[model samples]
Target: MKETVFLTGAGSGIGKAIAKKLSADGYDLVLIGRRLNKLQETATEINRPSECLELDLSLGSQIVTDTVKSWIQDHSENQVIGLVNNAGQFLRSPFGDDQDDWDLLFQVNLMGPVNLTRALWPHFQKNREGRIVNISSNLGQTPVAGTSAYSALKAALDNFTKCLALEGGAFNIRVNSVAPGLVDTPIHDFHQKDDSGSLQLKAALHGMHPLSRMGQAEDIAGAVSYFLNPNNSWTTGAILNVDGGLSLTSKDP
Candidate 1:
């Protein structure tokens, strides 16, 4: 049977890099994202057997369960053993009365992962083997102002990763997380680089890291790959920070 991994947000950024790395390492893929075309692009770049699913992680509950059910039915030839909870949206807090922002953050960032994991738990337990890697953020621990919700949700995810790890041991399932610092992904492309101000901000961000450079998606992908590798099977409940040493300092600008 093909060893397949279901990866959320596999369409781009860190998720895309992770997908590529896993494909190179000999794993089939089930790419999940909101955009079908984007997921197909990732599939087109890989040589191994792969499937793409258009899913919005924020729409938790029965939708998630149903999606998993049909997914299992459709890909019966593949043994799904890994899940990357990388689908998430970023948000800054202190929105005052904007309750929607907080709600959206909770649903997409925390609840979505929870719901999906719960939906997949039965399959993993039945197999008695699986791996889960969550893509979290450094802000979850080293939080700064105006990012309370995002940090808190990620912190919850980190804890959830740990809790699942503890419970999964009985079934030979290992759970871990990769908490990344600033990376040069589309999430950080809010400003036009043509402007001097934006250019200066980007430079400052690069300098903030002790490594004297901004992190690439591949940098974070390497850590996720480490956690997923069967050779490192003993490791579980670990939250590895792939932050280019940014977590070592109190810098964020």
Candidate 2:
């Protein structure tokens, strides 16, 4: 029986890369994202029995929970091997300027992952084996100007990931998180436009990281892949930094 991985935000960037990597390695997939086209594109690329669920994680927290229940019920025989709560929202509001949007960021970044993981916990326990990987960000670990709300939400997620791991250890469910630094993705484009910055500013941000280069989507995906692999069964509640060393290099001081 093939392992089944239920992944959120499996439409682009790191999420998409993870999907491809898992699919290539022969895992059945259940993918969720807001964009149907992108989801379909990912499914097509993988060429496997994949379900692309179009869901806005920010709007339907309960729905995410319920949907996972249904997915588990349907795939009972196959091990629901892993879950990657990789969907997120990045807003450029300076903390309190846009209350509603900031709230939505928290909803997608933190609440949705918690709800979905909680929903899937029973299924993971039933199998006595599972992996949960949260795709966090470097901003969550290090301070970033103008990203107060986003950073706070991600920090909450990191703490939550830790708590989940501690609880899941006895059940053999390895829970971990990966924090990506400056990744070349659409989220960067969104922030650049919102920040009114030149390309050089973005390049400078990428250069500050230890590798002195923006991380590729596959860079983060590889970390997630490692976490999902059953060989690393003893590792849980670990937060890995895939940021090219940006957390060590301070842009402010």
Candidate 3:
């Protein structure tokens, strides 16, 4: 029987890359995201057995837990061995901007993962083995000017990863996070009002990375795969930085 993995935000960007990599590496996938069409697109591209679940992480904890339970019931043949908590909201706001944005960020980034993990805890305990990888941000460890809420949520997620690792250790479950730097994806398109601004912003991001280029989605995906691999069974609670050396430098370029 093939091992199955549940992945949130599997519609695009790093999540999509992770889906492709894991599929190619011979694991079936359960793709979860808000857009069914986009998730289906990713599933089709992977060309493997996958279930596309349209879910919004901002809906709160109970909803996510119920949805996950339903998913498990619906897909009984596939034994879920791993979970990738990659869904996140990026809000670029200074303090005192929109309080709603901050709440939404926390809901999606921190609470969603927490709820999902709580729901899956019993399942992992029953199985006696599991893997969890969270897609965090470089700003989680290094603070920046404009991304206060995003950074805080990711930092919380990083800490949550450690806590889950400790709790799940005796059950033979491992939890880790991959903190990625700037990657060229639609997530940044929100700030790109026009082609010129987009290009300039992209260039600036590239310059900020000590490696001299923005990271690719696959770069983060590779790190996620490393943690998910059963060969790395002894490792847990690790925050792997797949940031193109961006963490080493300040934001100024």
Candidate 4:
């Protein structure tokens, strides 16, 4: 029986790539994102048994959780077996003492995934074989300047992923995270917005990676493919960095 996986942030970047990859592997999908048009585009491109929900994590909307709850309630008897908590936000804010930016980043980057997973826990507990994949970032491992809030949230997420894996392992539910470096995505374009030094900084970051190239969406998606496979029964509580050698550059001789 083909399994169903609910994937968030499926409108762009790594999420889009993962959706296409999983669809090609014959998985049913529930694609969640903030943009209706982009989500529809992903759905059309995949052409699988899929559904979409337009949701914004920054809105403090409970709609996403409610949708997931309803989905589990409706599909508990079906093969709904995996989740990809890939929705997140990134910003270039300084490490100011202001609570607003800090709280906002935590809410979107950390709390959103946590909340959704908590909501979906019952389904996994009942099924005894579901898996979760949280998309983190290389910044979580090595805190960089100018992205304090974003990096901190991802770091917290990595920790929480381990906790989830440990708690869910006995139930046969696997939990893991994927941390990617600077991928060639719109997020980086937004990160580089209007900065005169952006080009130099981008080049430097690219050069720092041992691969000497920015990561592609497919690169991250490949990791998702591996982590979610039924063949991967023995792996859990792992943080796989699919970052084109960016995270490993410090280990290089």
Best model number under lDDT: 3
**Model 4, span 22-88: residue lDDT tens:** 9988889989888989999999999688888877776654765787778766765557788898988
What TM-score fits each model? 0.96, 0.93, 0.97, 0.91
Give the alpha-carbon lDDT of every model.
Answer: 0.88, 0.84, 0.89, 0.84
Per residue, candidate 3 scores C-alpha lDDT tens digits across 1-253 of 5699999999989899999999988899999999999999999999789989898988988898899899888778889999999988788766889588788887888888988888888999999989999999999999798778888889999999999899999999999999999988789877678656767877888989889999999998889889999999999999988898989887843
The clash count of every prediction, one per candidate, is 0, 0, 0, 0
Model 1 scores worst on lDDT over the 10 consecutive residues at: 91-100
Better of 2 and 3 by TM-score: 3
Model 1: residues with Cα > 4 Å off, grouped in runs? 93-98, 193-196
Query: Which pairs of residues have clashing backbones in candidate 1?
Result: none
- lDDT tens string, model 2, 34-130? 9999999999888778988888887765788777777767776767788899998787666558687677887888888988888888888987888
Considering summed lDDT, which 10 consecutive residues are worst modelled in model 2?
Answer: 189-198
What order do you get sorting by TM-score, best first? 3, 1, 2, 4
On TM-score, who's better, 1 or 4? 1
Instruction: Give the total clashing residue pairs for model 4.
Output: 0
Local accuracy of candidate 1 as per-residue lDDT tens digits, 184-218: 88877765545779988998999999999988999
